[model samples]
Target: MTSLILLSGWGCDARIWRPLAPHWPHGLEVKAPDWPGYAGRPSLADPTSLTDLADAMAEDLPADAVWVGWSLGGLLAGALLDHLPAPRALVLLGIGEHFVHPQGVSDTALADFQRALRRSPDIAREHFLRRQLAGEPDPTGSRRALRELLGTALPAPFATLDAGLEHLAHLDIHHCLSAASCPVQRIAGADDPLLAPEVIARADQRIENAGHCPMLSQPQRLATRLASVATAPDAKRPESTS
Candidate 1:
């Protein structure tokens, strides 16, 4: 049987994908892989780099599987494609070739976000909910679910946040596009304020009406797309650019 692996983004847990799991096509086993430090796992003194995290996850994923990743998870999935034993395809959601950090937004912006995380997690949580899930028409339930998932995890270290932000600024998967032999489908919200439309256009982009968290904002739609991809014979692999 084919397997589907869901990779959640930073500060997010598997619960983020819960709404979309059951809707996947039958006969496809689904597993949501939680980030090491983001799902009540023990804190690492030193945070793992995106590559390291992907390498570690590759060890556990099925030899032949489809990877569905969101945000940071999408970046990691792209980074690990070459190493995965039998990664047949990838479905990226709410992520891009690189993360957005405006020119004027100094590194302090990340530091400030981290400080807020330390001092008043609730406030930080609220801001994150507002930014990530706010665009949803009915954000209340999604917000509540996010809060509960976040509560299960320990606060990500300021250093982790800093490293993530730095990596985000520099991440460019364009170079690896040629290396990905399998299909790659990217889905982003039409109104995602964080990632520009051009970024999605750079990949096999699919625009959704939902916000950054389409899994919550439009689970059925997202699920339907996944089902189609999983069952399609062609699977729509990326064309060789070389």
Candidate 2:
């Protein structure tokens, strides 16, 4: 069975992926582990260091597993390609080469949001959670659904959240995606409000009527698409550019 690891995005823990469990394909080994400083996990000495993040997570993230990372998690996953034995495949979901795209969230807007987080974590989190659902067919319904799904989990520590935003602000992974030793696939929400349209168009596949949080808005479809990738024949690693 292919081992599938689901890595959650900013402000979220492992529980964010729970809604997809019932609809998950059988016979595949799946695991969703919390990032450091999430779900009561200890924060790293330097949460902003990709190398530190990789080292802390290496044991739990086997190289053979098909790694699926969403948003900030996807950026971290791409960085791991440089430090760890490459996963069989890496799937980047709901993100683009640049997190702060001109058409998406501008640098100023992102900075303001970061400042808001420092000032008030709860209010910032709630605002972000609702904003994520804007591209869904029924944003209000998706909001209610996500609130229920994520209600049980405590928010990630302020340091972790801030560190993630730092990554978003500075990290650009176009090189990582192109130079990956393993196959790199991209999945996007058809109407993701936070991503530039070109980013969505570049996706290997997309889930319709969904936005940033497809796991909550279109779990079954997302599950089936993921299973297809997990079962497909592994691709040969391309030659290194370095």
Candidate 3:
């Protein structure tokens, strides 16, 4: 059985994965650890530093587990490949080569979000959550499901949330993914508003009728996609995209 490490995106904690838990394939060892400053975890001195983030997590992250990261989490996971022992495989969910892109979130929009985060963290988080469901076929249903799965878990610290946005603004790991020694795979939501159309089209698999939070809207489909990755030939490589 393959060991799986699940990483959630900004504004969310490990609890966001609760929806996928029931649908997760059998015989897989799954671990979902909150990022620093989340779920009572201490904040990094410099949360913006990928090196700091990677080093902070190095000790606990098993070197052999397959890592699946979503959104901002995907960027952090990609950065880990440069600092830690490569995992058996690295899976990126609803992530593009760059978080801030001409085809996706713009620099100005990101800066606006940073300002919003400072003004009202609660509203900012609510807005972010709603945005994630924008492209889903049934966004209301997706939002309701997400709310249920996330329950009442507290959001991460303001500093951590801000730092995550900083990463989204600057990090570009297309090079990292292309250079990784381990197999790299991508899974995208067919209607993901946060990802570029070309990026979604290039993914190893795309969950239909879903948006950015496929794990909430289509957990079973997402789980099936992951199971396929676990069973794929080790020699399989990521497809090149324009």
Per-prediction TM-score to the true structure, in the order listed: 0.80, 0.94, 0.93
* Segments in model 3 whose C-alpha atoms lie over 4 Å from true places: 151-154, 233-242
Query: lDDT per residue, candidate 1, 38-86, as tens digits?
Result: 5555444556465566555655566577788788778767777655654
Candidate 2 lDDT score at position 68: 91
Judge candidate 3 against the unseen true structure and give its global Cα lDDT, from 0 to 1: 0.83
Model 1 local distance difference test score: 0.67
Tens-digit lDDT track of model 2 for 169-213? 899877877778788878899999889888899788889989998
Query: How many steric overlaps are in each model, in order?
Result: 1, 0, 0
Local distance difference test, each candidate? 0.67, 0.85, 0.83
TM-score of 2: 0.94
| Better candidate number, 1 or 3, judged by lDDT | 3
Model 1: what TM-score? 0.80
Candidate 1, RMSD to the unseen true structure: 3.5
CA RMSD per model (angstroms): 3.5, 2.3, 1.9
RMSD of 3: 1.9
Write out the backbone clash pairs for model 1.
183-237
Which candidate has the top score in lDDT? 2
Worst 10 residues of 3 by lDDT: 233-242
**Candidates 1 and 3, the one with greater TM-score:** 3
